[model samples]
Target: MHHFFSMMFSLLAIIGHVSGQPAKGGSERNIDRPYRSELTVSNGMYWGSWGYKSMCPIGRYAAGFSLKVESPVGRDDDTALNGIRLHCIDRSTGSSDSYDYTTIESDVGSWGVWTDIKWCYSGYLTAFQLKVESSQGNGDDTAANNIKFTCTGGYYLQGDGTNWGKWGNWSPTCMGKGICGIKTRIEAPQGKGDDTTLNDVRMFCCD
Candidate 1:
């Protein structure tokens, strides 16, 4: 009787293993489908921005801007931004498109500022402009502080790098149907006895 019971148990074990194979295969297929869906959603949008600031003056100073961008996670990971352009506006001259900075593709983390010291022939730059274009439809949105800078020349410089140059007294120049100008003031360096003066600086942007 014992020998008979052992043989029955072995036969039952074999049958159970055969039946479980199909269920395991089905579960694997189901698990793969949802993972692919999540990947698709994560790769939809691209994010980035340009942060600006002013530097000390030593006869000439080239300011720099920082950029942060995120590529799609998975689906269109191969897709890349074409490039970014930087421009400077001169309000005094009423001339737009003062300078053209470098261009680069989408990067993972925050990139250092695009300094005028490196690109400027001399350490001289009046204002800045920035614009970002991407291959994707819903490219990204920039932050307001994206264009912050120090008060060196007694005025604030703000504009789309073209159309509007610099302005003074914190007033609007290209007010109607044109690019809006940014207002600024020059802060007298510490320990220097001078009154705070406000002035208008030129605008700049990337293409």
Candidate 2:
């Protein structure tokens, strides 16, 4: 409901802004949806579903991120990583915190509170690595456990996530400028079995 309202308000805000202004003599809007490259984790785990990709607006790139993490559950079912969010900014402006830029995320599991955001001081996010626990036949299963992102400044940011898996190799760096979109795979609830919500993810790049 919140996401839906946010989208609606954004659309209405754009429409209102345009409608309230007089037409310029010879101005036009240019929409670009250029495809750059998609970054993927080679060893991501299984049994989850993919969601539609959510993208940052044109002229912006992801410079930060946040995670929806469910902390450890004693002996009960555990689903460590639940969702991922990409916070976008126009780095050329040199002010990621001055304005409240748009943020987007793909499908999110119905668990966990979003953690504090992590940001790149001067650049955008470039590459990523996932820590995913493989399935345990009859034991607890937390498919995706944690994540780490590399900033264009040559530093890494780790998530405040659970420790249940090994880290995978970093994904290929963005072929363009930086990451601009995201799509995630999530496992549905299992009534009487282990619940491992987040399984895999893909990051999209933009020029």
Task: Please report the candidate that would top lDDT against the real structure.
Answer: 2
Model 2 agreement with the true structure over 65-102: per-residue lDDT tens digits: 88988777676667889889877778676645436565
Provide TM-scores for the models: 0.20, 0.83
Runs in model 1 lying further than 4 Å from the true structure: 1-54, 57-60, 63-117, 133-207
lDDT over C-alpha atoms for residue 167 of model 2:
91
Model 1 TM-score is 0.20
For candidate 1, give the lDDT of residue 128. 36
* Local error of candidate 1 at residue 3 (angstroms): 60
**Candidate with maximal TM-score:** 2
Candidate 1 per-residue C-alpha lDDT over 85-196 given as tens digits, one digit per residue, 9 for 90 to 100 = 2222223333223342222111111211222222222222333332222232343221111232322343443322211112222212221111211112222111222111
